[model samples]
Target: MIKGMGLSLIDSLDTMLIMNLTNYYKHARDYLAETLSWDRDIIVSVFETNIRCVGGLLAAYDMTQDEFFLKSAVDLGDRLLNAFQTPTGLPRTTVNLKTGAATNPSWTQQSSLLAEIGTLQIEFSYLSYASKQPRFAQKAMAVYDHLLTLMPEDKLLPIFINPDDGKPKGTDLVSVGALGDSYFEYLFKYWLITKKASRWGKEYFETVESILNTLAFKIVDQDEEMWYIAERQNKNINHKFDHLACFFGGLLALDAQHAPTEQMRERHMEIGKGIGAFCRKMYTMNPTRLPCDFVNIVGNTISNPIAAGKGWLMRPEAVETWFILYRLTNDTKYQEWGWDYFEAIEKYTKKEYGYTGLRDVTDSQKLEPDDVQQSYFLAETLKYLFLLFSPKDTIPLDKFVFNTEAHPLSFFEAQ
Candidate 1:
């Protein structure tokens, strides 16, 4: 919550900081400093630390012009670099700060999730830019460069990669969801942050086109008019969509703004709107007005509302897309949908201590609350909701590109 709150303060400093939230920033800063000082050798997960801690500190520094945040970020960045000591430039998933020992999870078979290795570019590249250290950026880009050579015939990467050989590990499971979402997210964001100077932007545009062509499906039933992106496994399409995948609509909408031609822009918008509409249905069709973890789309219609998991773990991807669509279209209906979602969260998930996840969002009579409340509930979920309702000028779309965690980083400042 501290990391996210710090970023939130940066996001709306003019309003939030003025609203007696300055103390919150001070508290977060002091806590981070104290923790780092006391636990100088604390081990951390690379993915979690990059998004929440490093991303938070950099954003706080940007907002406050405080050297403290910058210094902390640099310290954390140097510690994280130990994970990249692998032969293939694909960092291990975990790093020990004290011992400088890094290793992948024991469960995986000499492989790592594609999203884990592929999603570090934005944070690491920005760290290099901010600290004037090219090695951080180079290490991150090396992972991308190696992965590019391993793209499949369809140009869609598998969800897992063999870090030892820098090759794709799975052929059956290819997706823009779960283990693959932010890989594509960073491609566009990295391109945008670099002011289109990087080839990653062109790569991002091409990859989106490939995904739309190969993975996307249109469902045109009487009750459902939605576009679902499916996963390809074992030479067959798995007609499944997850709430996590819903972020694609927002990504598509954002990428449309940078389309090269009028025709391309219109096409991107059309696809984005189709997917956005489908994502909204994932919420409205559920009994609790919150989406399940997965829904199966069979042949031209949604087969079941909750075909897979019924839990809603306070995820932000669906609402995050809603925020983007609303920002792009100025459609009040998106706002109305978001309000409905918020009400559902309050009704089904709220607890006295703090909001918890729902064990079954489809069960209204006995709404079971899971014990966990993810930090993203504050970081991405509430932040996106706040941005959705705030003045459009609060964080102008043209001025900022939000990180995967919904932390807005200024494009102008990044350069």
Candidate 2:
């Protein structure tokens, strides 16, 4: 384990404040002030550090007017700036906190995943504004500027790109899943976070059009038609759907609100609902009511399903979309689906200390635990669940935009 910072604790601070766990919030704040240190020599995932620690701290600082949170965020942001010291301004995958040394992960020998390199914009842009450090935003925007030159005419960027030369690695595969989900996500969010004053808004609209024309498809299952987005390899389409891609539904709905025309808004919402419904169906296909990490869909048939080995990772993307859809449309059906999903999670995965993942979501009689509860479980999953039930005024969508990690940074500075 790379023990660089108090990731879980820092990530959950805003949640504690939102949930009004006053005692817990105070204790977490004190722990950060009294115990947490950023001087340790540990290698950390640059993406994770930015989204959870930087995003969470900034959200808390905005909410509570706490200088400690801002100070902590700035300190961490200063250290993470080391990762962007590359020829192309695309950051390495990992960096040493104390030594200012950086490198890509082993899986990618000389390239960085699209999502990792592109997802830092929202966090860094906010950081620059909050700290008056324009360098953070400049570095973040430099990556986007370089990517614009390399983005294909179809707008389907390859999943991997060389960090040093700013070129797409020779890969035919394109996905909005593990390696590339949030790159597309941040395009729209960055625009909204700037209150639609940034040029990225135009890019967001164009990319969505490209996605609809190229990557989206519908299939009939059990006499019910549903939409699912697919990835592409050269000219061939892969019907394998990723649980992570479930976030597309909420994204489409959110993006729809900012659509230039009412007709475009209606069309986007219609497709968003279709995608959300199909994702909910994935959970119901199994006995335990949890989705697999990935599934292959062939024509109208799902085949060679593999949930036994990898299992569920307590993903929140589907639920996150449902919450956003409910808020946007005032639809009770989305809330109902979220409640049903939560009940299944409570019955099957709840543990004494915390919830665990499932090794076999298909087996209700013997549900095996995967023993890995990701940080997003607390940061995104539970936060979305809570907001799913709370009134719209809790964290108004117009006033805030969430990072991929679900940390809500306000559109206006803290008053």
Candidate 3:
């Protein structure tokens, strides 16, 4: 359960600052200063630690210029660095905070998820800059550099990779969901965070072109066309879709503004709208007005919920995309869609103490709460919702880049 990691508290630090909750922010800061400790021997997820804890600390430090935040972030970043001690310098899934030992989770079979390793670039790069430690940047870049060597001309990255030899593992499967979303996410964001001075933009665009050409497709449903990104296993395409991928809509919209050409910009924005609409439709299609975690698209309908697909974990991806699309296009429809989704969650999932996830989004009458409130519900979902209705200038896209956890780390102009 990642005990003592301060998941929700640390993850929501930037949101408190952005929302102008001064007392809450001060209390959180004091908690981090007075209570947070990394000396425990607990095993923590490297990806989650970086995106939530380190990213949140860095975002707070950047906004407030407070040494305590930076000190906490650097301390956490140093411990996380041990996860990259693999032969390929790709961070494993979990690390021991006390002993500096790292290992892949048993289920991963000594291989790391592509997103887990690839998502570290932004957090560590900023940490390096903030702490004046080049090793942090170099260690994170090593993973990206090694990945560049692995990419074929097609640029569709495998979801699983063995850290021992830095080779693609398992079937040649590629997805922009669970195992691979933030890898591509960080590629584009690192370029923005660095003020476009790095090779990240070129790499990001190349990979995105491959994603559009190979993975993205339109599924027809009852005479309606919806755009969704599919997964590829070798030569075969799988019609499985994840709500986690709903983030792509916002990401595409964000990328469109910075595209190198007008055509690219228009193309990305058009597709972004399609994907955003597709995600919004899921809420209406379900009886409870909430979408499932994942579903299989069978021609004209979504059927066969797999694993935990029927559950709604209060995910933020769809709303995050809605917020970005609304901001970028000034479209009131996006805001309308987001409001509807928020209202549904409030009606069904809200409890006396705190909100929880739904056990089954498809059943209107039996909307049982899972009793677990995810940290992202605060770090990303609610934060995105708060920013959605706020003035666009509150956290301008030009000045700040968000980590996957929704921490707004500001842009640093090139020297």
TM per prediction: 0.91, 0.96, 0.97
RMSD of 3: 1.6
- The true-structure Cα RMSD of candidate 2 reads 2.0
Ranking by TM-score: 3, 2, 1
Clashing pairs in 1: 172-233, 172-234
> Which residue window of length 10 is worst by lDDT in model 3?
299-308
lDDT of 1 by residue, 1-415 (tens): 3322343333333223323367775765666555544134656778877887677666666667778777877877888888898878788888886677887776666677878888888878887887887788898899989988987667788877777777766454878888788898999998887777878877888888888888888877576456878988887888889888989989888889997778778877777777878877777776888878878886765644534487887899878888999999999888988899889888888889878898777767877778887767777887787778988887688877777777666774333
Where does model 2 exceed 4 Å of error? 1-4, 222-224, 307-310, 412-415
Which tens-of-lDDT digit does each residue in 1-415 have in candidate 3? 2487777888888889889999998988887788788899898889988998899889889989999888888888889999888888888889999999988876777799999999998988998888888888899999989999998889888888999999998778788988899999999999998989989899999999888987788766666666889998978999888899999988999999999999999989888888887887778888878998887876667663855678888999999999999888898988898899889988899999899998888888977888998888989999999999999899998899989999998887433
> Clash number for every model?
2, 0, 0
Residue 402's lDDT within candidate 3 is 87
Tens digits of per-residue lDDT, candidate 2, 247-281, equal: 99899999999998898798788888888888888
Better of 1 and 3 by lDDT: 3
Error of 3 at 56 (Å): 0.8
Error of 1 at 80 (Å): 1.0
